[model samples]
Target: MTDERSSTSPDEQRSDPHDSSDGETADADATSDENDVNENDADGNDNADEFTIADFHDASQQEGRPVLTAAAVSRALELSHEEANERLEALADRGALERLAVSTDPVVWYPTELEDLTDRERVVVFPKQREIVVDRPDQFTRAQLSQFAHLADANGEQGYRYVVRPADIWGTPHDSFEDLARTMRQALGQRSDALEEWVHSQWDRAHQFRLTTHEEGYTVLEAQSPEIMGNVARQKLDEEHVHAPISETEDWVREGSEAAIKRILYEAGYPVQDHRELESGEELPIELEVRLRDYQQTWVDRFAEAGEGVFVGPPGSGKTVAAMGAMAHVDGETLVLVPSRDLAQQWADAILEYTSLEAHQIGQYHGGRKEVRPVTIATYQIAGMDRHRSLFDDREWGLVIFDECQHVPSDVYRRSTHLQSKHRLGLSASPIREDDRQTEIFTLVGPPIGTDWEALFEAGFVAEPELEIRYVPWGDDEQANAYGSADGREKYRIAAENRGKIDEVRYLLSAHPDAKAIVFVDYLDQGRELSEALEVPFLSGETPHHERRRLLEEFRRNERDLLLISRVGDEGIDLPTADLAIVASGLGGSRRQGTQRAGRTMRPAGGALVYVLATRGTREEDFARKQLQHLGRKGMTIREQAVERGED
Candidate 1:
């Protein structure tokens, strides 16, 4: 029977090969014949030959052992005996299976279940240690181990021993101890102690706290470790009696509190990192067109030292020039935020004349143009718009100069300050606001850094002014009735728009024919009527922006000695040549407006004159007194002069 079986047809030999003794070969052939008979009986198909790894896995699981034999797989999958044996060997090399007992006639294979691997089996076969166990063997891949082996061999390093815990080795979690050991061994192959140094560096980074600037003008404190956040919050409560809610990821604070918070964190011994850094600006020329005055130089030096603050100096005391000097000192990408388009243009002109920036480098961001450049001069109105606000989302300004920053108390105007900058400078003649929101400026920018006006005047940096109050009687009884009956805004309008002030404006212009004068009024209609009656150029909110610029230029060139300007000209418009001013109307009890109107003629051209016109024996008298009181606080004396009906 053995000789006949060995000499069996080539087809039978190919189906099930036996290379052992006659009795063993007969047993194998009997088993193969039994498997064929069982398969044919179960499915009645003799030609089916297909198998997969999943079939072997299922068979091992059902048998309650990690072991699966070739004959069992062949019967379960209906594949040829040779095909089953080839597939089993392939799976064992892939780490999915292991050769359990090779001494047996038919080698017994065991499937390697990463999730269920024993401690002994989880140990890597490296020569460094007898026992290096992996906690989770399921998280590692075979490719990772292979790469590690290749990298270690390339570096000519061997016998790596891992002393760190598995959790610490990976810095997070890993499934396979062998794979993790391989990766660490590979990383350390470059140099000795490299893996230990890397783990320590990761721990330090994960524990550190950092501050990042958000688009909404707030700073976010990022803490990756929950334990660190809890520690910080507990310490804050103990020291300051404040309960700060701890977030696993981050906390938020106002931008204004960034300095204070950083200081607190440092004092508490917390490792704090400031993620905000000053961006390197484009290089500008060091030379300046205009030399800084003594006081201006002092102001610039102080501003550079402080980095950010409100600079308070009277008009014509070189506040704008001092700001220009500060910009030159910093020599970075600058953004000048002004309250009006006229001031925006003036800033643009000042930048071009004083600094190395060219016309192309200086862009105007307003209604007409939204060009962006290294230096941007924008009005608050344009910067407050939703579309324009988005333009600054990613911009990092090196310096931000807020010209006439008193306007920042308004909700819409305050939006312009949402931009992030390394340095900030607020320039204002009178930092006070009518709404008593000066504290907002201190919080958003910084506290006031003042320059003495009286000192400047004594030093000849500012021109002394001759202040006068001219009282004009009402035109008729009908005007008196309207002023008496109106309330709220109407009463102020009626009082300010008294028709008799028109004659007073005309007289001031004729009296100062050779002296360049600016006629300032509170109401647009009053300014228009006076401009038409006196036949002079008028500038108001309704005036086209380009035309307004042309008119101011014409006035500067001596073509028009007298120009009629409304309250829009009260702040930030530089009329240095104007030696005389006629204030016919004003917002009631606005100290800022009164001071700005007086400052229009404060240029250093020998001396200047300011004539304030008020309606006699009415509420205008009281409001005028208030304006004069504000000017008096600034060290100006006013002489009252009564106008007869035909004084003009």
Candidate 2:
């Protein structure tokens, strides 16, 4: 239970009460004049003695009524009556203290020069407790009080308050403030003790049994225990109330007996939580055997040590395998998040093969799959739909693994950002986004703990694809006549499916006849046309998942030479075979997209071949150049050529 109380700042209370009235302007002028006079008086007091609590109290007794008698003043200062009386008169003359009443029976003094009564009052009330009582009932109403009660209830054991009004309940004068204080005391009956008990229970639950002294230092207890209880415990010795400092509590807890502390906590209504640590002579599940590559091992170590961070690599860098291995090491549930439906199934199937765990223990939640695993793989799309329900359902993930973390910058991604998880591991082929929202990702997720595609390729973690940029010249008639009504996408599609390029696709197919060649196109229409012209199978977003899997399996087994694929393969999809790529269409100038597309061939199965066919003298070439720049900077020579010799 957290603390919820009206802890408004003293600055807020000290604001002028007449600020809303028309006379505020005149009051401000008067305050300014008084401030100037005070400054002048201060300047003239270079030789003046410093004011003491004695002088302040003497003057306070003089205000309104006799708050203090001469005998009380002598007792407070531990001085002779004549000596105290002479000192009081001297203080009154200097304006440090003033006489309140006409009769000198027992002249009480008050600090008349102190305009800010609240600060002086706080010095009396709070002192060493680091607490302040506002005692202002005029600012709150009945409904507000009820609301405050509700807030206190929500905050549970940490809330405390007292409310009082002037009704002569304590047999004191209405203007004396004693009746008001008595009412407040009645309202707050036993609340202070209740708060102390609550804090003691929390510390006992932390399982630190020793009641040791804590010096002044901040302590961050992960949970409640006896050491913590000791910190809050108060003792009375020789008319003094002494409490342990926070530092002492920390040291005592560190050396305390765990069992004794747990017992004390259980007695105090705070039971010790069972954090399942591995025990001696207790064999773990035999099915937990995991085999990891060197890179995967590095990632797991990094995640364990860093707590929360990202892991980046291109396709086939074994992100899923590393994540699953890390999950096997955790005691609680693991939640794996992927961007797309196809990738979700791929991950689930992969997890099943890696662990000897039951099929039901490895779950799948995505567009096309059913969720049944204790260690579930959920899609970001479904998780982002209705957040309150989703967050409530999946708040217990021990390790949250995000696949394709580049998509985290999207608006929909923020839905899962605040969900509490102590351990997080994000996987991305390319962590960089079109918009520089990497910082937001770092906050929501953790810092990127992995590398990009270029790093993976250089380390031989992935394959090195032979690059070729083929500039398929637009037909001479395309240059003479413009497709005026066509959108940019439509024009690119027309150019991609040009008959000459169709023949060139056949020529590329013929050149890599035995080797499996993938024809990568932009539009579905272009995929269909190219598949028909080359007499080969193709896959697109519209294709059912089952059929798509079957077709990819056949192609991977070297059953198909020319397989046409669309932008659906842009992400981390399984394309085990078909090394050669024919970039039939794409956005110009962004090497990131091009690099991702080319990465399709980087998986070390057979050799890789990239053939980017862009229409000559169009924005497609410019886009292709921009994409090639990222590769060229990484030491990949980008060679360009023309499909058919034509005039510029």
Candidate 3:
């Protein structure tokens, strides 16, 4: 909300109304007060009439309150307290407002109607629960929360709930606790002594341990005090993590166990401050061919300070470009690790297109190719193998980058986290896991440096697609009977593969004939049937890499209008942006899968659409909602509609 308000009619405008001691002379008094709140003298509001019922919203916002006190209203509207209280009681009697009396306030007024809350945003803090709820928040509020809170859930319409987790406070990229507190006050619009005290204690908890490189070239883990070292660190750690105790508060960390040490300490309630000076490798000339956006530059600047971070942003938000920007900032030999050969190829192409890296200087070290140059791109599986580990041992890498970093906490994937570098970077739109090991992502890499997805949507940097979940009836009695008899996963699968959806898919594709689209199917049988019906090629795991490359290139160049893909296209392979996306099956997939498919059309040009199809009167309906819940949390609206059964 801004202090400066725009001038419009009472119904259209949100501004504080001038109160009159007496009716006809009130306009003159308002003019003299010169309240800038939503008044437009140029818009003929100069001859404004008496008070409007809607004007109370202006007073509420001006006073920075979700609920208004009579004193606050008096100060905002230039009226006496008695007049304000009388007006509030009248409005309550008219059913336009409600009043509540709390221990801290005598009485406060809130809108009886939800639409009456016309403030730019509404924020409610539950200090005891450590949660913040916001409705239709602006970019500034979202950015503030990302620093020290985790987005827990959203009501799918206008409300977002963020929970302040210990990890959030520990990994906060602030200079001091005072600065963090100031940001909290700004975001919350008020200070909570109880919440601030809890936050301060957590902030102190994060700084209780430190990891540093010693003068003799060994790593040391230090605690804030001897008691902490003995009680927390010493009791939690073992000889595998550290060689021995160097002192009461310092331990000589074992070689190659630095990551383990940090993880153990962090899990034990102390976050280790890493200050080891590592190699920046031999300098390699590099520069970004494209200009960095303001937020991308800020991310690079922050990472340059911390030496490690994950670039978390929605799909099509130019994360690869930002990674290139980070590479240019470091200007050293870089090793980029991806999840698949397709992504490795995409990374190599992006580095070439956006950076001044020579083609010959870059190499791919996967099953298809094994060349390690100054700038190498390899798959995570290969790079972590004991045999392939020797390939990277000789050449010092200044930076190690992980694409699709949500996989970093897995058993095999975590092996690659042991790789030492001066800088570490990870990229993922959704860095979540079913096992709840997401915290390991931060400990393995670094704190997250991300742009709020809403910021990008508002700035038109990414399109917020029109998302709809359409539930279709079963094609025939046979399929309906089969689903009714089955239970558990089989029942869900039968519902998801409902034959009725074929016609719905045909209808949607026919309706948007000019729009480029991708239809995602989970099983091979369903994919083949849809491919045959739509007369489109289905790309799946069985498709040859070269053919996948050819079809994706055609799609990117706009030569192909429609394509069918399997779960393989959910991630790892960068499918070209489409104008429409249809989930023909697999509504029960993971939340990441749903978002990855919806994100195919989330480009800056807008006018994107995503249709999720589920069988009506089955568990598939619930599965569809559950799958897209992550997008709901990210501020995307999900509309639901029922499909009419075709004439039997």
Candidate 4:
């Protein structure tokens, strides 16, 4: 029901079409105004369009109830008679507010007509909740008050109620004044204390809320509900585009969306307790006959003492071997978590070689393969599939080892609250990066098992390689054109695979003629281009998995001195025999990939050389700098020998 024009005042009448003195003009103008209003109404506009007292009243009680009088509602809201009363009736008719006749002469209105009037509202406030009230006594911080107000504002139907009777608040603790303070805060905003004091002093109202001090002189206030204290939550999906499993309940705010709330909860602080409670003296079978290196033993000892932590070891550093050895010495079933199916298969084979451990019992779960037994190697993707439940909730994994510890800090892995293995270990080579969130690896897995990359590399346990970073000039305008797009990957490929890099690769090969080498590229076209230019066999995702393996084997056996591989060679599989790595193209600006690629040539077969070809004066050089920053190199060292003059 829209507002009627019958009660227009003299001021409002001037604007109304019917108020004109010319009788013919009044009817014509009225018809035109009505048509415009009808068109606006058909478009379902309310906020932009003007409303009348009748419209306000009708809007207030569309379901067949008397709407709150505009004059009374306006006075109550303390707005001008016209401004307040004008929209009040229509808002009420639209079910935005409820008309409650508190008195025959003085009517009242309430927002939202919720059933449970005594319900409490929850808000996820930030910074620490404990600190919000710990020291403050005479006053509550603005943040605290605002949080309370946001919660309480929902108590009224439309927004916040200006006045909530004292008797209406229920379930508040005796002598607790936080709820009253919160309510007063909502009504007063920043002027809550004044109103609160006024109410208590003049009206002789009891201060229902109180604060108590602890032995430490910390003021601890009882939990108080928000001003509105209404348990209504927005029906929306989470910020990450993932829907909550329990769609009905409002307890858990969409995960990352409620960071402030989580912070408050964290500030509340949980008691620290050791997650590991290993049973004593009942050790299980130890089958593997493994000779642990001093560094490997040190990693195990640190892991046992640290409770949970990560082990940093480059490729061929025996990270997996050390982890397996540690598992063999410990009792109970071990859970090995790998990144992909290829790694899982590699781990399964490696573990079998170390121990007469039943190969059948060593289960692998990833891709289409499924096996569950005493020992299982599951991929992170499958483990993090169910966000609500833990990955190992149904069963217990005594020792959980994440092969790629860097992945453990990812948001997807963090959501796996069910990965409750207290005795856990993470193995990775390049842990430090630009995205230091990977530092959460400490929180998720444990402290560092290896001190630093250099420590492990120097101790002869991990690989050590001499790095050679070269600038690859672009071929034609192709490289320059690719950099214009937002695709960072293409930018990297363009710079890395520039024709100038082909000459450098040849130079590095000529420089170390006898050393077996593998050229790493990010794109298949780059690899193909390099393969044709250098007359070498190249490997990519398009290459059959078996054929790629065979090609790598041939190169390792000296049948081929050079093998060109795309990013597929960044992880998994092994190249123990390759003594030199030529990084033609790489994942731009990714420090992890840089370290892992460098580690490819760092295997214990004596020290090797690593050459990284980066395009100069482009984003590729910037990415190279970021990758090498953590490598402990303070300055850029390069030998720029242009193979072609003005040709590229």
Q: RMSD of each candidate?
A: 37.2, 26.5, 10.9, 27.4
Best by TM-score: 3
Q: What are the models' TM-scores?
A: 0.58, 0.53, 0.83, 0.54
Candidate 1 lDDT, 461-518, residue by residue in tens: 5665788888898876788899888888787788788988887777777676667778
What is residue 97's positional error in candidate 3, in angstroms? 16
Assess candidate 3 and give its lDDT. 0.81
Error of 4 at 142 (Å): 49
Judging by lDDT against the true structure, name the best candidate.
3
Clashes per model (N, Cα, C within 3 A) = 3, 32, 0, 32
Model 2 CA lDDT for position 496: 54
How many backbone clashes can be found in candidate 3?
0
Cα shift from native, residue 436, model 3 (Å): 1.8
Candidate 2 or 1, higher TM-score: 1
Q: Model-by-model lDDT, in order?
A: 0.62, 0.53, 0.81, 0.53
- List, residue by residue over 104-196, the lDDT tens digit for candidate 2: 674666666555333322211121241323222222111122211111111112222222211111111122233333222222221233333
Residue range with the least summed lDDT across 10 consecutive positions in model 4 = 130-139
lDDT, ranked from best to worst: 3, 1, 4, 2
